[model samples]
Target: MTAWQSIPLIQAEFLAGRAEPRVVTPRGDLAADEQATIALFEQARGSVVFIATTERLFNPWTRNALQVPRGTGSGFVWDNLGHVVTNDHVIAGASGATVRLADGRAFNAVLVGTSPAHDLAVLRIGVGAGRPEPLPIGTSHDLRVGQKVFAIGNPFGLDWTLTTGIVSALNRELPTDTGAVIERLIQTDAAINPGNSGGPLLDSAGRLIGVNTAIYSPSGASAGIGFAVPVDTVNRVVPRLIAQGRYIRPSLGIRTEEQLNAALSARLGIQGVFVLEVEPGSAAERAGIRPARLGREAGFQTGDVIVSLGGRPVRRVADLLAALDRHAPGDAVSVTVLRDGATVDLNVTLDAGR
Candidate 1:
C-alpha cells in the first residue's frame, strides 16, 4: 500500500487516542505603505458614486410604458452643494438618472449641464445633512510617467471599486462625442472598464488628478490602457457648465470637414483645413473668406484653405478648433489661408461657439 493508504488508519487511531488538536491562530500586520493605501481608499470611497439611468420604452402592442434600464456608470462628488460630475457618454440619451452613494443612499439626479466635446457632465442632487465631501482636486500638469495613481469607480456594476496603476503616458488626445478633440489627456494603466466612466483617478494622497474616461481594448474590457480627462481641464470647464448650462467654445465661424487627414489633403493638393462652407453674416464671411465651390471645368475648386489661425498652423479641423479655443470671443485674430496658391492673411474676430 502506498503511504497515502495508511492515513485513514492513522487518523482513526489518533482520534481514538484523542490526539491533541494543533490549531493555531494566524496574525499578521499590513505594511505601513499598505496601511496608508487602505486609509486613502477609505477616505476617497465616500466621494465616488454609482449612476444608473432609466428610460421609458413604449410598447405599442400593450399600449403601456415600460421603464427599462438605459445605462450605468460612475461619478464623483464635485462639490459640497451636491453637484456630481460624470462622463457625458454615460448620460447620453438618458432622460433621467439616479445617483447612489457609498453609504447606500440614492438620490434622483437632474442634469445641470454637459460638455459633450469634453465628455463631461454635471448633475445636481438635492442635499441633506449626509452629503459626502468632494474629492480634493490635484494638478495633472506636473504628473510624470510611472507615478503611482489610483482609480475609484464602479466598474461593471461593482460599486466603489478601487484599482491601482501608474501613469502610462500624458498629453494624449481623445475624440469626444461632438467630434471635438479633448487634448492633454492622462493615460494610465488602471483597469478602467465600461462602468468606470467619469470616476476619479486619484493620486497617492487621494487627490483627484483625472477623470477616468476611456479604455483601449478590443474586447470592450480593460487591456491595461486607460485614459482620463485631466483635472485641470475639468476645473476650467465644470464651473462654466454649472453656471451657463453649456460650455461655450470659441469659434472662428467657419465650417470644415469632420476630418481633414493628410491623405485627403495630399490628394486635393492642400495642406490645411479645406473650407467647405462659411457661415453667412459670420466673421469668416465678413472677412471675405471664400468657401469651396463646384467648378464646371476644374470639377471641384477648393476654396481658401485655412493654413493657420491666430498665427498657429492648422492642418486639420481639430487643430483649427484647438487654435481658436485658445482665444476668446470678440478677440481679433489673424487668419491665414491659401487662396489660389497664394497666402492671404485676413483679420477676423472670434465668435461664441455653440
Candidate 2:
C-alpha cells in the first residue's frame, strides 16, 4: 500500500478504537434534606429584595447637585401593602433608594420610618399586583442554639445568594452608631458580608427569624460571626413604623442623659442611671420617681438612681431603654431605684414617648 493509503487505514483503526462518551449516571432524587433546603431557598428568594441607595452631591464648581450611588444592601417584602423592611444604616444617608425584586421588577422606595436604636427601617414601594408575598414571621425568643439558619441577601452586590449556617448564639448585644446597644440579637455562623445587611435570616422552616445586620470581623468581611436583629424586635418595630412613620418606644417619662449619668455614677461610686428630671404629669411623676436636685452644699442631691427596670439591671441609659423596649406604653413595670440610701421598688405604667 502507498503512504496515503496506510495513513487512511491507521486513521480508521484509531477512530474505531477510540472510547465513546460515557453514559451519564442518573442523579436520582436529591437527598431529602437537600431538597428541603432548595425548596426553602426557592420560596424565600422571592421575598428578599435588593436595595440600592443614592446620595445627592453638590458640585461647588458647577453649582449643580446630582444624585450618586451611595451603597447597596438587602431587604424583604414586609406586607401586601407595599412595605419593605431593611437596616436603618443601609439607607441612613441616602437621598433616594430603589428596590429590585427577584422577578426583575424595580420600584422606587419611599422612607416610611426608621428606628436607629433598633437598626431597622421601613420603606414603602408601590408594586401593584406583582408584589411578592411577605415572609412568614418567626419568633426569636424560642430559638435554640445549633438550629439551622439560612441567609439570603445580595452579598457583595451578588444578588439572591444563599448561605447556610447554624444559630451559634442568641441574645447577643450589638452596639449601633446611634450610641445605643441593640440587645437580643441573633448570632449565626453564616457567611454574612457587607451587602448582606437588611437581609432575612430564615429558620429551617424558612420563616423569617432575623435580619442580618452586622459581622464581627476585623477585616470587614465574614469571619463566621454574624449578628442579626432578632425578628421579635423587627415584628414589634416594623408595624409601628408602618403605622406611625416612626417607632415610639415605650417611655418611663423620666429624663436621663447618658453623659451626665456616667459622670454622676462614677463620682458617686454607684453603677446605675441617674434620673435627671421627671416629666410633669408623666408616668414617672405619677409613680413618684424623684429627680436629682442641686443641694445647698453645691452638690447634687441625687433623688433617684435607677438601679433596675423590669428586673433588668440598669447600669447605663441604654440598659434602661432596652428594658423598656420589651414592654408597651400601657404596660406596668417595676422600677427599682436608690433613694436616700434605701432601695425602693415602685410600680410605674409606661407612657408613649414624645
Candidate 3:
C-alpha cells in the first residue's frame, strides 16, 4: 500500500470511511485532519455543475419513455463567459444534456469542443437567467508534488462531492482509454470516482488548475491514483475550440531519436536527444535543421549531430522541440552543431510547421 503521508490536506475516498488519521493544526491539538479537511472542502468548492443526459437503450418495453436512459456528471463554472469544461467521456454520446448550477437554476449546454487525446471538453451555456460564480484559474506548472489540492464533483451520481489530496506526481504522460498520450498531466492522490470526470481540481486558494479526468483502480473506485488534465493544456485548447471550433498546432517539422534508454547515457558522450532527420520543406530543414544520417546509421546517409539550440544544450529531439516551443514560426534562432569532433554554429530562421 502506498502511504499518503505526503498529502495530509486530502484523503482518498477509499480511505474516507476508514479509521481516524492524525493531522497538524495551528493550535497543535493532535486531532484528526478528517474533520478539518471536510470544512476546507466546503469553502474551496466555489461552484458546482450538474450535467444530466439521457440515452436510448435496447429495452423491449413501452414506447420512447422506456427506451430512454439517463446519466449525470459534475462540472465547475469556468469563466464569466458561461463556459464549462469537463471530461469528454462524461458527455460522450449524450442525446440530451444540461447544466444545473449551484444556485439551483438550470441551463441548456452545447458542446464547444472536445480533445479525446486529453479527455477534456469545453461547453457553452447561456446562463441566460442564473448567476454563477466562475471558478478561478491557476497555473498547474507551479504545483508541487506535495502541495494541497481539492476536487469538487458528483461521483457515482452523488452531487457536490468534495475530495482532497496533495499532488502525487507531475509531467505524467498517462494514456487514456483511446491510448493517446496526454502530455504534462498533474497526478494527485485525490479520490476521483465516476462522475468526478470533468470536475475542477483546485488549489487551496480555490483556483482551477486541473480537470479531474481519470483514476487508477482495478475495483472501479478511487485507487488513490488520479490523473488530471493540466489547466495549461486546457487554456491552450479551450480557446481554439471556442473560437475556430478546432485546435491547430504548428509542428517543428523535425524528427530525432527517442531517448528510450537511460543506460545509454554513457555511450552518447553527451546527455541530449539525437537529431535523426529534418523533413524536406519543413520549418526545421528550411531553418537549417540537421538530421542524423550516420554515426548510428548505415552508409552515406550519415546525419549531423545537433548538440545545442539558441545556446541552450539539447540532449534529445524533445529537448530541441521543447526549446522551440518557447519560440514561434518565422523566429530566428542560433543552432550549434557537433560534427567530426568539432563544434559549428549556425543561424536559422524558423518556419511555420502547420
Q: Which candidate, 1 or 2, would have the higher TM-score against the true structure?
A: 2
Instruction: Name the regions of candidate 1 deviating beyond 4 angstroms.
Output: 1-11, 15-28, 251-328, 331-348
Off by more than 4 A, model 2: 1-17, 251-354
What lDDT score is found at residue 206 in candidate 2? 94
True-structure lDDT of candidate 1: 0.88
lDDT of 2 at 324: 84
Best by TM-score: 2
C-alpha lDDT of candidate 3 relative to the true structure: 0.73
**CA RMSD (A), model 3:** 12.3
Question: Each prediction's Cα lDDT score?
Answer: 0.88, 0.91, 0.73
Off by over 4 Å in 3: 1-46, 56-67, 253-287, 290-354
- Backbone clashes per model, in order? 0, 0, 11
- Which scores better on TM-score, 2 or 3? 2
Q: Write the per-residue lDDT of candidate 3 for residues 187-285, one digit (tens) a residue.
A: 899999988988989887777889988888999999999999888777766766777665545355666434322223356565655556678887667
Candidate 2, residues 2-78, lDDT tens digits: the string is 77667677778888788689899999999999999999999999999999999999999999999999999999999
Residue 235 of candidate 1: its Cα lDDT?
83
Give the RMSD in angstroms, all C-alphas superposed, for model 2.
Answer: 9.1
